[model samples]
Target chain A: MTQSGYASERETTEGRVFTVTGGDWDTVTGSVDPLSNEKIVVNMGPQHPSTHGVLRLVLELEGETVQEVRPVVGYLHTGIEKNLEYRNWTQGTTFVTRADYLAPLFNEAGYCLAVEKLLGITDDITERANTIRVLFMELNRISSHLVWLATTGMELGAISMMLYGFREREYILDIFEETTGLRMNHAYFRPGGVAQDIPDSAIKKIRDFLVYLPKKLKEYEDMLSGQVIWQERTQGVAILDVTGCLAMGVTGPVLRSAGLAWDLRKTMPYCGYENYEFDVPTATTADVWGRYQVRLAEIRESLKIVEQALDRLRPGPIFISDKKIAWPAQLAVGLDGMGNSLEHVAKIMGQSMESLIHHFKLVTEGFRVPPGQVYVSIEHPRGELGVHAVSDGGTHPYRVHMRDPSFVNLQAIPAMAEGALLADVIAGGASLDPVMGGCDR
Target chain B: MTIEPNESSTGGVPVSADPVGADVNAPAQVPSSPRKGMFGITGTGDVSGFGGLVRRHPEIVGTAKPYGGYFDEVTDALEEAYPGFADAIEKVVVDRGELTLHIKPERVLEVAQIMRDDEALRFELCSSVSGVDYLNSDARRLHVIYHLTSMTYRRRVRLEAAIPAGGSLPSVTSVYPTADWQERETYDMFGVVFTGHPNLTRVLMPDDWEGFPQRKDYPLGGVPVEYKGAEIPPPDQRRVYQ
Candidate 1:
């Protein structure tokens, strides 16, 4: 039996080697042999039009295919981890929320979960608070995925997707601003609980958004999925199997797309995710297209989760009941912005001296955590976002390190990009969703 | 932390905020005094109860046998599987329902390989590799901690190894390839070298940047922020709770 085609196959020590141009197009390209060809090294942006966000790629290429890829990261380092050592436990949320600027709530939730575990108050978090956390986290996941879709679409020359993606994301940001007083780095998920309760207006907005987004998603699918160029650019491109995903520590949708439903929310079940009823969407393609499909499907799954969370939203205290650990002042919407309710402020400042002192004591010298360490991980939009926090029985953290999903999942780039076409590198990198803010933090 | 319930001075009482006392889980560490001034306050501003404050780290002590939950199964599996389990395993401290195995620095690579490939231990995912600097309080100041996740069993375990200043540990990147960048990040932040890393240059900091910034003794240098009326010093410079 002989195997002969446009690209002829010959047996060699390395196994069956394909002579790509040897059969039909011999004279046109002179029997092109990749092994003998001189490789050209191409540097693609710490600042490129594709906008992987300060990511620089060094590629060794033979013709149009990438022979090897070396990714140069840390261009956006902000020292969030080192700076966290100087702040108190509660104040730590503000610093960490900025680590992965896109998925801010996940960072806060993961940090708070670790801190709560260290404080021995993991089980003590209020019901309403847990619901709110889950609600906001799922919402943030949608927004982050939208940005991924938008930016990735822009990079792949799907200009309409870029516009539609950002346009849909604005709705979620509006809700965030209404609830947390900011869009991106809302440090709303405090250690004990959320910073404040979700207002009726935000709730109404979310309810409206839940209904509005599904139709918009369908339109997006109709637009993006129906396009042959989008499919051609993604399908079977940047392929990575389940083993490659695992060995390189890739998780979240990239792993999920590789046909493993290894979601921390399902497997580990922190933040009372066990109580929620939602399916983990997955695809078996293990390519850029699979990741895109998985992400879009995930947004739908998240919308379902968000709807359930809203239905289950009971009116109880948002923060923990323990006054020693929870925020002292009542958070309210002032003319300037979110602040202590005017009546509570008046009572603290003028009406009661003892109240003022207690607030000052708790606020200034944050409640001391017991001397111990704990690592808490949550499924972020990218992957397993873990926070390894250590305390020295002091108000401030002894050490805290975020094993960010972007940071870990970015490791799979070389595994995915090498040997693929030069264009597929961008598709593969985008599918991994490496937000440099998270990667370099 | 209930390794020996009877040996505990508090007598079945849980590990509390009472930092000065002896607990069963926390063996007596090298005594380090509290900050002399109050909450980063300099000058002889005497007696604000900060003098009496003793902020102690949770000491690393071996928990007694039949360690509860999946911890027992993990240790027993490692014991049966690896010949040098005792020699390699320093201490197993189970705190907050999580298992932490303190391993010898040299044996980290072998143990990591075993932990990954063994059917009984299948911690295939190297979830995180980071370093912590417990400066002034401990003699071996720099400690590298690895968080491993077993997807098959949905279990998580921590491996901690302490090394002195300028000390190096065998790289586990051979066993778990995910540790490549993380080990580099640790090297970048704490200057704890991973001996067999393929390319061990700094990952986060600039190439020419000097000093390990995450070390506790390393000065956090910064200029103060000023408003129209008042000036607020940088976090490292200002008075804060010690």
Candidate 2:
């Protein structure tokens, strides 16, 4: 047998290059020490399933320990903000709703608030409309957090947790579907008000939901919170202190998990959040488990707000009074889906000629916004969903920029994953609850 | 007229053109918009279509002293905290109940540092960093905006800096690490260079892409699509209501 381990060994700029034939394969592996493999670099996704979305991670590993981790995003970038430039201000809601696909209502709410502020109609939004906004926003928050729990649970090996979480989320989606025509990307929100008023059937469904959710939540807590595997996988993993989170602009459950109660709803009240009575949940651990606890508590808090908002709901106008700004079509559900009501069609066809003219101009060109820029932010289920809207006093927006929480919170991935085990990278990133649709948009 | 929410039996949601007329007790006057009948094609010899409506650049003017609410407190603290406050700032505009401090592009980093560490004005979290291109309106076409939140005081302030096309500014990632990806996005979209960004590369676009997608001068690229017996032009080519 030959004593030589390799056919050839040389050093290049890439460091070591070795050539081995079948005859020398056994000899080379036998001669090399397993621990002396030096550095290992792995590129783990842009397509991998466990990444939660179209997220890529570059990891420098020493055995199982991750030395450096870099999260590479932008695979899902659809140029949403760029596309918004060509559309009217009201149509911009459709584009932004697709940014954070899960929290579609939050995206619309933030964008609408900014546009309304720019139009100087923030105070004029009807009381009923504000209540409806709060109601739907909280519902959207629960659905989004449920998806987070489902996806993160799936990634962390709690396969049944995914099923249970999504089962509950589907129930909420049904309620949303009953109100808006589509379950997702409704674009229901407008600068002046919602696309349509909520019907009593959807209200009844929401009442049923309010009763059905508490039991399911309790069931989930019993199934996973005390489980040993769940604890081992989540607790004391990915510890980023309050300073790290704040510096990285990490808000939402991640920031609350780190022990600072800096919820925008509580700290900087908007959309009548000050009127709602609820507590901001916090866990001092600042780890994956802390995030999990915080999210669960938040779901309960949201349920409280939802119940309150529902009770406060009264019969009144759901849109602003201004015909020039309000949506021309009074939407109604037909066999085909939500569309212009027959009554509206009759009025324009038969009644006052001025109403018809106003409808044409409003629907076609949209109302012009006063030329200026304003920034309005609301607390998204993920974090702060901020809209920076600029207008040149034209129907179309000059430029609209969204500061999506997923995009900002993802910056903390490296700070959490650098010194942890390679598996912990998945756990830490899931804790931040990043939605790539929002991050890349 | 006000209390009949059960007027429509279909799903119990009243679906009537009645929304405008249903609320009898409340005073919501749906103003009759200025009537622009047909023949109201603007920018022509026609005398209709609200021709009196003039489009002018919304001027940028500084707010006078005692800028109301917390804005005054913020300006005073920044003045006391930073020694070069006046030299570094271009203007302080308070509009729509939001305070905007327009700092010189060259002095953004220094201003940001003072903004973060100032005990009285401790803006610990940077909510966002974004770019807006004011093309054909301002000489410095690219404008960068930063939203800072003082968690302690529950206050928010916006910092803006203007730079020319293809211009450079210091990165604020050192003070607020969250700006790393956001700065990259601004650069990728608007071509505003952050000189000291650790890894300044195309974030939302391919590295070899030719033009910035969000710039005002860049064309909205699209391909023509053919339908049943007709062709629809791209969005950029379509005639829109100006």
Candidate 3:
């Protein structure tokens, strides 16, 4: 209510205003303006929701334009490869499956193929098992791509698409959970064959999913394709041509989007992928929009493969006949958890002493693989997933290295993001679909 | 000789104890090295009679000419394309439907350049670059494996180079720019320095981290885990299959 030398008041026609405190603040105003420098550094993640898992991007910004982008990974590193060295050959699937959480089947398939090759038993893998692998891997590809579409759409301001994307993804995950007993990190694949046969319930769920997904995919395309905002955000943003993709070792949909039809399924068939007839989709624009189209098309292609694999699925033993490498326990999830079935347990416990001893020895100390190394690559959702496995004629792995597609494809971020608008960094990264679990494994 | 207790004190590193007396016809024998049982318990732990198992660390012998399938064509093409191939190539190992061309560490760059540029052997894509630690098996224990794919030919070839720990291998980043992060990862994990890489920093591990985590001798350090107040030893401290 009182006016002193520290406070001053001014009256206008409409109102009265007061100014308070020391006005001659030269020290506070002496520093240069932050906007005047024309360059700023922004750290975008490791915690940000849009970064996808724990990827950190350090960007040098020149007023909303990215001058340089340095992607810092390894925050999610769990040393799965190192841990694999301590486990038996069959137990390796558990570790590798967790590497690429989005595409666990791909990781398992690649690792198993490498192990089978090392044991010189590639041809011995049952046709039914291989068919099952193709079936699950194709389903995994669709689920992984759906998450990519959903998250990328959310990150680019289409919130509703994210919900729809996840809804369809949940259907696929339900199929996975019913079959493998876990939704995300299913180590269903084993060295000689799959851990068990696909149950009849899982088949029914998959058939239902096969019908439900195409309609959802059409709905997604109709919703986002003509939206003006989506078009402006994606088209011509973060463009990396075929040459850039090749130089950065970008594969899968990103490389395909850059106009190279180099899908390992087509070029180098594995797990009887050649048996299924599907087209490798490509887009020439080499931008975020192109990646979107390519991934969406890939989902359709995966659905086609899944349908064929379903039809070709014949009734046969899923595990290899070789008793040496085949898992001893007939695994089934009990009320407590996954364990040996009652019949298998009863047989091993009461029937023959030799059978019990054999089962115990095999389960604890697995069959030894002949010493050698092999690299097996499978086309994962993100790119080419390669497993470099070495066995020193032992039950446990000597060394196993996974060349995860997310790890290799993330290297192209700087080439794709630099000199583009800062917001496009998120777009480009989302387009690349870098899963940090796979990248840092 | 008396055995020492609490070997876990050294953070569960292998004791390098003398092997048992099951030394019948083992090629590279020092002693009978039986893997310790669970919780650092030194015993056969092999109830199924695998204790006498002598694992075969088969020395990779290069296959003689006509190296089967497309391998022969790739070799012929490389030999015809690059004049220095004879000197650059150390060994040609064909195993399990895959071809491995072991090259001198110093000549990796030159060999890669030729492998990429040559019309006959155009491995345009270097699919994967990784390092393996063959700790006691080889004198040069650190091996860098490069998996190259020829999209034009639809063929794959493995080029590998073995170098001593801390030895520098010529970086193939010039030949395959994609080898950038892979070389960094190799450097970070196996400590194999890439001589000519543009930015050779740790890509996977933190900058301040010490010791290559993936090396065979490097300990997989972890505190003993306890379940319901009963302590269970860590993996390294537990039984190992040597």
- The TM-score values for the models, in the order shown, are 0.88, 0.88, 0.89
TM-score of chain A as modeled in candidate 1? 0.91
**Per-model C-alpha RMSD:** 12.1, 12.4, 6.2
lDDT of 3 by residue, A1-441 (tens): 446666677787878778764455545665767677889899988999899989999999989988999999999988899888888998899999999898888989999999999998999999999999999999999999999999999999999999999998999888887777778788899998887778899999999988888998899999999999999999998899988988889998999888999999998998888888999999999999999999999999999999999999999988998998899889986554457888999999999888898898888878988888899998999988999998877778888989999999998999999888988899999999999899999
Q: How accurate is candidate 3 locally (lDDT)?
A: 0.84
> Is model 3 an incorrect, acceptable, medium or high docking prediction?
medium
Q: Between 1 and 2, whose DockQ is larger?
A: 2
Q: 1 or 3, which is superior by lDDT?
A: 1
Residues B1-242 of candidate 2 have per-residue lDDT tens digits of 11112222111112332222111321111111332323224357755545555456767998888899999899999999999999998899999999999999999999899889999899998999999977667878789999999999988899999988767899999999889989989888777888788988878776655445676655453311124644333364565664
Ten residues in a row with the worst lDDT in model 2 chain A?
A1-10
Tens-digit lDDT track of model 1 for A326-412: 889888765556778888889999999999998998888888888889999999999999999998877888799999988888888
* TM of chain B, each: 0.78, 0.76, 0.76
All models, DockQ values? 0.56, 0.57, 0.54
Which regions of candidate 1 deviate over 4 angstroms?
A1-38, B1-38, B45-58, B223-234
Number of the top TM-score candidate: 3
Flag regions of model 2 displaced more than 4 Å. A1-33, B1-54, B223-233
Tens-digit lDDT track of model 1 for B96-191 = 999999999999999999999899999989999999987666678789999999999889999999988778899999998999999989988877
lDDT per model, in order?
A: 0.85, 0.84, 0.84
